[model samples]
Target: MNTKTLVSICSPVYNGEDHIEDCIKGVLTQTYENFEYIIVDNASTDNTPSIIEKYRKKDSRIRVYRNEKTVCMDDNFNICAGYCSDNSKWIKYALADDYLFPDCVEKMVKVGEMDEQIGIVSAYRIAGRYVTSMGLPIEQNVFNGAEILKQQILLKLHVADGSPNTVMYKKSVFFEFNGFNSKYNQSDVELVFKLLDKYKFGFVHYVLTKSGRDKKGGFYYLVKHGFHILEYLDFGYKNLSNYKSISFDKDEMDYLKMYYARAIVSFLITKCAYFEWEDIKRMLGNIPEDIKKEVKKTFVRDFPKHIIKYFVSLLRRIKSYLRDKKRFEQFT
Candidate 1:
């Protein structure tokens, strides 16, 4: 009798013909073989569907599903997850653009089985050339989810939450939390934060997955709209009450105030074109009124100093440009 834990691996793809084969091969070649590979194509108009079908024929473990209509990415993710076998103990998301190391599932499952309280398991991931999610201690493999969540909020740790591709979720815990929130673009981050608030976190200190770091992907979208920092701040603020042991020292509070102030100013200066007023208002809505007022006050008090610095930098750039133009004219 094969007694190993059954795992369900899912890949949600849309126009992913470029990397779907690699993603599939990563799963098919997993060192741990007792698992199902689910591929949900989000109505891809390209060769993605055919590529998936090619693999499904070769491997009976591969299951393919197609959406009649292309759904939002978050919705598609939830739809993909919904197809997991009820008998499976864990759900591992292998993003269409990202592939796993051969031992990825084996390693993540080993850590997860170490503790029943561990609701999420994460490992280091290669983001481009650098290994990321590195704040955890070298020897420690498990953590109190609340403490990890607190540290993550305070910017002290980043081991527990990251791209779905880098982590595995307890099947029960995932459904208990109702999966991803379709309303937020950063729903994966949001869901991980929510999970860490009430459950233990497990970490495998190995680089198990490679992130594609697509410049046109979700992270870039968040950064382009200036929603990345604000969304994180909003998550931190909303979860503060849940971390009863967490307390901010005066310095930390001051730093956060300045950080919030700078984010607001930076968004206005650089990201205004990509954001609507309503979108900005909604992002800021989750943050507390007191913190909002404090940051506004901080921004007001520091406005003149900021203006002076901006003018000085602007003047220097203007001088450099004129000097360069003069040098070119003389050469001509």
Candidate 2:
């Protein structure tokens, strides 16, 4: 990588006062100097704006923005990307709560330049303090989108554990795909699948990002994150066949089971059992009798837990909605 190449690293955070400062610190201290660091304060009600302003003045490369109206995670991120320098052909979207390894960006940019067809380079994100996927590390490999996507679906793994923070892409390639679709609250998983057609992923294979979990205020965030999972499922199923995927084309039975498993698990986590039952029914409707029994068996094994969580989330949503209604009527 040339030392003179300009780069951009950014994230959009809502009420992210806690990590905003440290996140900027990590970027400013990066071994690479020819880059701009940005933080989009997406209408944070908390002290996040103040923190960002402090850093903005301290470093010329550090810039910040606050959305006038609150934007969801996906839209906010795209807004941050829109601010990247016009010369920035390589772009990155890091998380408000995640910091990169000192050399992460430098190395990825170098690798990106090495292969022009390589649309994105993903790396392992070490969970420094978060409980994600495997309670382990996720390493996204470097390969053409089609072959890697086959492995992703067959193993049923979120490609690179399914978050954009652990990856960097050619800015043009990402924008060509229209940045990211905002129809999903957590659409990054589906984004990987869609990108497979035109982009080959390059892997750096090191733990280059650290996501710190257990932020000070976590309870509400946990619920929101759970709900985001459903948004992901909605996107995945609606566009399932649209993805330019290289299917292994195993028996139809295996495909059926996987489809069922994906839906039920997503619904169970987001606590959207009934809301998503239509999708599950459609999937089950096409499967063999034996496969149906297996689905039932798998679902039954943890029936009690899923039921409890689903009802809890449903109740919470109901309560929140009711409270909002009461407040809305008073203002009107």
Candidate 3:
């Protein structure tokens, strides 16, 4: 095993006592041995730090750092990556709640080493019970960045857009984009799109990681409160316009514009109660002016029909409850 390439494996954690050990063990057990495991504790008020220290004393490769105070997830992630050794050529993120298979690093590095132009390497991941990061051709090992971006925008491919657990990035390219943006909740997805705009994309057709779906995580909170729709709209509107390489014809762009507008209006009509008025306004404010106007117009036109449908559905639910009650009464 000639470990020529040094990978900086990073994990940023806060109050992750429940699963941090599993994450640490997964990294320590990697089949590929030449790597530095960097763990940055975000001032966790739990057993997380002690658990990390326990491992740190056992393995010389494990380096631990702690923030004086907790910071935003994206900011902490950036800080973790910043601690990578200068000699490292690649950066791999094993999130605190997620774990990778034994051969995960070996397979990903193999693809990455195949070409210097390949800046991002992705593979299938078991998210809960199902495998994801699909839609790449089985026979193809690499793709042009612009073409991959086009496929992602058109909803034809999903290999390039996944959580940190599913991908490995070139250390230089990761820093070139200045790491994840702190403002957006889906900064990992945003970074992938940005990377694909410049460098080549590589794929490994095997499931190499398992992503834990923590219901208490920020992503789950947003989706549970129906705020993910707005965040996604903001992410798409901001990044999709910057890629001049991914050209969309007039009709396609028009369809996508209306598609976004309708999505917003639908969310407003159905899930408005989940959000505060001020929050709704703030989220909508980030959207482009033209799309905001289209959302308003779509809301005005569709509000009545959606209300009618909602009342009808509510009435049906009431009727079903009444029927069940009547049956119980007869049995009594």
Best lDDT among the predictions, by candidate number: 3
Between candidates 1 and 2, which one is better according to TM-score? 1
Residue clash pairs of candidate 3: none
Residue pairs in candidate 1 whose N, alpha carbon or C atoms collide under 3 angstroms: none
**Predicted candidate 3: what Cα RMSD to the true structure?**
3.3
Candidate 2 residue-wise lDDT, 1-332, digit = tens:
65576888987899877787777777777786788887888889999888888878888988877799897778888899899999887777778887877888887887677677888777667665543333112444356777766555544544454467778878888788877777754466567666766678777756677776454534235333344334333444333466655543557436645665645554454445446555445444544454456657667676777779778988999999999999999999
lDDT of 3 at 43: 99
Deviation from native of the Cα of residue 329 in model 3, angstroms: 14
* Backbone clash total, candidate 1: 0
Q: Give per-residue CA lDDT, model 3, range 1-332, as digits (tens).
A: 55579999999999999999999999999999999999999999999999999999999999999999999999999999999999899999999999989999999999999889999999999987788888777998888989998777665677866698889999999999999998778788888888998999989999999997767877687765456666566655545678766778887667667887887777667666454565567566666777888888899999998889888988999999999999999999
Alpha-carbon TM-score of each model against the true structure: 0.85, 0.72, 0.87
Better of 2 and 3 by TM-score: 3
- Stretch of 10 with least lDDT, candidate 1: 266-275
Q: Output the better candidate (1/3) by TM-score.
A: 3
lDDT of 1 by residue, 179-239 (tens): 9998777888889888987889999999999997778888888886667776777667545
- Give the lDDT of residue 231 in candidate 2: 38
Candidate 3 error regions (>4 Å)? 224-227, 238-241, 273-276, 300-332
Off by over 4 Å in 1: 242-255, 272-288, 300-332
